[model samples]
Target: MVEKNTTKTYIKEWQKAIQKEISFLKKFGGTRYIVYNGRFISRDEMFTYYFDTSSSLPIPIGSKIRLEWGGLKTNGRVLSSEGKGMIVALEKSIGELISEATLLHDPWELLENLIERLDEIKKSKQKRARLKRLMDPTMEPKHPTTRIKSNVHELTLRSKYNPVTFVWGPPGTGKTYTLARVAANKYLQEKRILVLAHSNQAVDVLLAEISLFLKRKDKFCVGDVLRYGTNSGQSLANHTEITSEQLIESSNPKLSKERTALLVERRTIKQDLTRSFSKRDSDELLEIETKLARLLDKFRQKELELLKKAAIIGTTLAKAASDSAIYEKEFDLIIVDEASMAYVPQAAFAATLGKRVIICGDFKQLPPIAASRDLLVTEWLKEDIFHKTNVADSVNQQKLHPHMLLLKEQRRMHPDISAFTNQYIYKSLVADHEAVYTNRNKIVLQTPFSGHASILLDTSYTGHHSLSEKSSNSRYNLWQLLLSFQLIYESVLGGAKSIGYVTPYRIQSNLMNLLIEELLENENKNADIIAATVHRFQGSERDVMIFDTVDAEPQSRPGMLLVGKDSERLINVAITRTRGKFIHVSNTSFIKKNIFRGKTLRQLVDHQMQHNQQVTTQKIGYWIKNQHSKLAWSHARKQSKVFQDLQSAKNSIVIAIPEGKTLATEWERMLAKRHPKVSFTLVSKQPMQHLQPNQWMDENIAFPFILIDEEILWLGQPLEAVVDVDPPFVAARLHSRKVSEFFIGQLLKE
Candidate 1:
């Protein structure tokens, strides 16, 4: 019997999650759009609308939408989207009220379908029993009769009794490759398989692998493997043959011809109906409309037949539950890749569609993206199936689980590079593959990291602070930006080919992109380098990985990248993406002081300090002087220090403040009295009352900075009150005469 309490709880939690998502979507200004035009396509029984393409949230094809205009709202589904426009199939038409409407992304259909499926499972005894087994945390797994082997793939292929199997795949463990092999093995046995993942990209990847493996085995056939849902651009470019559209078009000529003929007939009927309506021929119009409806139904029936015939089908979890035809089908085995990123309800719904389920993912990586902070929403919606099943807990406690297999051999990173994650994050559960050791000597480093496998580029002594961006929550550090760019520049100069710059903020990534572009343009050099957040660099690797922890300063606590529950996983991913060397740039002292809950980052700093070469400001300064621009910059904590340094100025001092901000009266008076002979010029968006017209100029500045005697430059927000009151607010001081004079010339030119 299905437990009423459990069923109700599942429904309640899923509803709460849906509400949370809707609230988040509205709060973020992602759902509302101003419609430019709307028209009805009577033949296809759909409506097309055009709107601005600039949306904060991406609206992929096949997403459900709702149109609100003229005191009316109708639900619809996005049929196609191109530049600045989209076609949608709405439930009903609002006649002649298409002038200026609102479009909202409605995800309720998918969530409601999931909840209905859960309810269906609750009503079925067999499904309820299966769910109990899958979710039971206290159930002990059957022990293996033979000695465990090192190859997890072999073990998984040999097992046949478990109804639910979990694969603990860490980074570089060939998880997707293993899933493809298993699917291939099942196909050879003539068992139907359904492959699902949390994202469309993951689905495409696995389907491509399956197609390749089947072809290698000489068992491949047209329409044997199918990619469902909208085809991604990358997949189409790489493996178009696996898409359902391509397969159907290539294999079935009769259906293609019939579809074309039906489309032509429908168009003719639509044209005829328009004329019939103008002539007041109601009977003729009704007959033409009836013919169009029949044709559309026939077309849909043929398409559904082609979709359901594939022996191996692949799609995302959301699509699997949302598409009615797909959700109704049954398979012998359901394999979920990246299961740890799947929502609990979505994963559970997938589990009910097959006789046996195989889940592959690493809980150590990112989970489902949940924006709600409510405790229940997070507990139900954000948690993955691995955590719900107690599989992760079992592996963590004993390094092994009977029902789950852990892939321990890593083929991505060198031993030196992987050791950090192996010891601290994975608790020595992972080891390097034999090939890594055999080919370890083949890897070589460049100039800055010539003889080192890892280095800690500590910026604590530089007095550089990470400042919050005015427009967003993201932060950026000027010192780390220059330091990271220099490392990349010098590394490229020394023949480094592939590099990955992983940071925690978008603002820092954007700045790095600009700097890298400038470097590439000036030097006329090319390299395979990417600057992105760790989330974007999850499944990618490079020859050299530069991880910049952008959070520093005492006033700002550790960012979510360092102190959250997934901080360890974030760090693990960052350090393990390198094949040759790893460079961590940050203020170690600040991290050490602020990070209280997580030990992964703390242990990482200590490990690097103990085992690797340390790069200090002295070495960085020397490198900058010799290789790149010859400028020396230092950090100061207070604006008062800039005033003290002004005592030595002889010629001119320029203080530029941002709009609506002014120089502190006390600092202005002190600087004037202390440096009487120094020419002081204040640049502001408006004329200041405290200064003479000759001493003040009306000009806009992005941030507050001071230039002293055309030789020393102070870069930071000096005019803000927080700079003086907060100890962590830092400003950079550069003592390069040429660089200072360049700035002075630019300011004085206008």
Candidate 2:
């Protein structure tokens, strides 16, 4: 095939030519001299030692000169017009220029290689037809796995193919765990894999997960795994098997030898330059310049060698793109974790380095952040391989190209906690058996008021807003800050293993950090805790979480930056981050009035109320007396429902109403002779004793309305004793057939 001489064909060549210019000028122009007399001179030195009175110079005196020595660049003016040579001033000396020039070799050679590969693919008809075949629906095959979860099995089989495969991972659906296992399985087959992500933290997370899986279950020694990236900090530093950049730099024999020799040479040059200045010898300067050039070339060669030997490499896209050492390298497969959070161009660039690609991420959690609003609307910029390929209603329903597997089983969140996201985002998501039963014991440990698993604190007050003119961080609300501290203290007292404070805005995060620091400084609790902005805590989770909804007022809006885009993603992330408990702090009235009609927090609160286990007890008084809603039991619809529950009782029922409570008088006046077969006992208060086996209640029970019988336990606060005002809070209809038998059994024993 003939190559066209367009920008696409010669872009890399242009880049190389520019880099060569920077290199040649740095070596040729980077020179410093010491005057015979005692004078310190640096930067843009004259071409001649003295001006020639006979020959006129081509350029005028006092002209501005810009000089770049390797990486060291600066501009200055000619200082003086001497007889044959003019003195020029500079900011940096020869030592600094030499140090910077040594690093002038372009590090973006890998990116250039990827661009060239893309150009080749675009220009070649055979490669394009092969890619088209890989994406063809007729060519796609159905392969099964021995693993029980169909999603993991499908992903493993698809990893062998040459086309791009997407694993649509909604929140809590074990994306990292699934991909790590697949990569490990491939490694056992001796296929080289490259794991990538947008951030170092994400890459480290995948590395940690991979190490844990290999050590804990597979029992496979992970000696071949290598982490190659700019980020030196690895969370799994103790696991010596996982090699990091720091380890390679410090331990590689060739790199160590050359770097050590270079350092020694640099020190000797500094000493020689000082001696020459005293002896009035200018020839040492040339010797130092020649030595610097040789040492730099040797250092770069060693760096290239270390990268070529790495079999299975893990790195962020930015590091992989810039590292020149890995330019010519290719992998059998590249697994991109958190692919949805990366810009399309970045993920595409990483894809060019490998033959087969596997992208695992949830577009429902968060999309790539675009700086300009216009870019968000641009069709091509918004596309991620994972999301773009997933066009079918469900993974199983697909009949055509772009193979995908949807991971529907969530194992991270409690059933009660996962219901929100399951409803709003992942309609097909179901909780695994372990996830459903894991939090059962944890629920009993929490006090009733602390929100057994989830709670929503809805306030009507306009929270404090202090906007800084210089930043985009949302202002902190004083009320929300106090509530976060209160919950943190409560969680600590409740024996929470760890706590995390999630705020949508930076200002709230900053304020919450102060409160957490105060708690630590006072030595109040030794609980493990951390507070961070929501964007920073994407790949993390904790035992219990407190999300501070910073936008409290109706007019201020919920999140400043999350207005038009689907804020449901932000909510899903916050809700699914906790395995034990989640508390949402926001203004209820504002959310109801101005937001998505209270669909976010209100839905969670309603879910919690629906899942709360009902405690059966005959005594009730405290709620009627303490709660002051005059029309509490006045809702006609609520009253009708309560009577319907009472009428359904097969045997005797107990009704406890505090004195002067209007609902009790109304019940007495209304239902004295309605049902003769069912016995009715009305009492002002019930004694503090075991009313049934494992059932007890104090005389001042706070619930305004209560009806406990052989079969049902109904407790609620009426809106107006009429039509439903707040359907979720108005009444709770709970009934278990065993409750009636258990009540009779207890009575017979008594």
Candidate 3:
């Protein structure tokens, strides 16, 4: 056979290819064929009743024909040959079919059509067999572990090494509510279940939900399932309450105030750090930078240890049938909440804790640690593992594997919010079923609000904005982040009018402490809050949230940029918790630096007015300049539309930063001293508890000078950071000045 380029071949060429394949199959002995509504369907695919042992047949390969019967009409083609050299075909739908096929094939064309239809019938039979297996009664509602909801067609979400069935519901979608029902149903089937979550705050909510459904049974454990990432780990009950006292007890309770005092003393080191690198002061600057770095590192370790010691590590447990002592105390099934932000290895290991597992997480919220070299979602989906007999490579293959499902119906968030994410963010699992998902998930592009959520462009007012680089021993962006955090806090969360604040970065966490002190001294309002990484916020819901998608990467980075994967998970948690409103802030370039910055996100919705007008490069440029819009217009649709190219933006930003240059890719302190007043705010869910959130709320913070971030933009900073190495801190150009002013205010508060 001569082989040539077929890429540009029309559908008719594909038809001939099928005809040739069918002819070859005819030479061999063919199996009996079955007809469904006069259309060729395979006997193997014919269904008597659904069962665990049932199998499905394949559809016909390729031969175009239309069938009408039983008030149903469908366009189908001979897909392929099946069963002992017999040919078959499955119907390929082009558009929605509301009417049924009622007409019959003419008798004159009957035998001719029938013989040809044999192949089509054979393919249908194959497809039917597979569909039967999918609908197998035992595999459907009456399964050993699940309650079958007759009205819905279930798509089970699972993975090979990880047996967990993961589900994710947005805000107002009742993630906990759905979880409780699923857990209860599974538990009723005589399975020992473990319900785990990452956030200390989220643990509280889950425990409460379980308490309502089932009184704590000896066979069950639910609560703050502590995932001890540290080397020093321990075990405890699932729903153990953690308090400040526990932290003190974990360490020497006697050292409580002593540790706090040491942390306090480090604040004075800031003065020495502000100096520049000069021949006369270079030695002194180096000495001060070294001391500050050590102090910062030390404080972070001790503080984290304190938190780990306070959190509850699940029961003294192991899985069933495994008597390895460690695996001896086993759970029948395992369930993890707030899994999006979890490290892949930690989550995978946790999933294996039970004979069966269910994981619930939103990929859009956060992603796995890109730097961690471990088995993760993408890896698990792509790798092969031991089956009953052989290993299976793909989870989503034609043959059923008793694992893997995708839950696409999400109703917790306002349809708009969910739609935006599904459109501009993650798209793998969102469904299109009208019965299951009534709302069409329409989106209003470029809509920005102040109270709940909003998007803003580069807005500027009259001000002396300096782009300065911060001084640091390492080419990190700690200072830059610090300044940005303050500006965001005051402008968005609540200036002096608000009570709490949260920061995921350790450096910012430390700086927040310093700012709070000064505020309290000056008699500022104190609001308590939960602040940390997306991992910290996982499972825990909050009211009034703010997210900063601030990355220092230029226009060519991969994956998520300003927001770390774990941080993105946290940001997801933050946005979902806003019962009332949520706020999001990022460099005007965030979308450009991330996913929305690409061409794929842009769908051409042509100009509405007709003028026989054609859009040219020059016209497009004119359009962009006049509207200050980022996307191009297309000629397909009548209405003009803007595209959100998030993935492309992320890739571009990653590309802009040179590799191994920490300061270039990540935020730097010097940049923190640059801009002074570029800021924005968004709203989030209401607080779960009435008491104000965050300790920083009570700080007496203030500032006197206009701090600039331009101190280190062109310093001896590294260019591109290592792809897998820790990102150096990149300063928020505007925040340096704001943070400095806020620090002064905090100091004077007393």
Largest lDDT belongs to which candidate? Answer: 1
lDDT of each: 0.70, 0.54, 0.33
Residues 358-434 of candidate 2 have per-residue lDDT tens digits of 87777777676533224222332344544443433343352323466677787776665676777655654544547
Sort order, TM-score high to low:
1, 2, 3
The better candidate by TM-score, 2 or 3, is: 2
Better of 1 and 2 by lDDT: 1
lDDT of 3 by residue, 323-370 (tens): 132223356666666665553323444444556555555555644332
* Candidate 2 Cα RMSD (Å): 21.7
Superposed by TM-score, candidate 1 places the C-alpha of residue 213 at a distance from the truth, in angstroms, of 2.3
Q: Which 10-residue window in model 1 sums to the lowest lDDT?
A: 276-285
RMSD to true structure for each model, in Å: 9.0, 21.7, 28.7
Model 2 lDDT, residue 595, Cα: 57
**Model 2 regions more than 4 Å off:** 1-139, 142-151, 212-223, 231-234, 244-306, 376-378, 381-383, 390-402, 443-451, 461-473, 522-525, 554-563, 598-602, 605-750
Task: Count backbone overlaps in model 3.
Answer: 181
Best by TM-score: 1
TM-score of each: 0.74, 0.59, 0.39
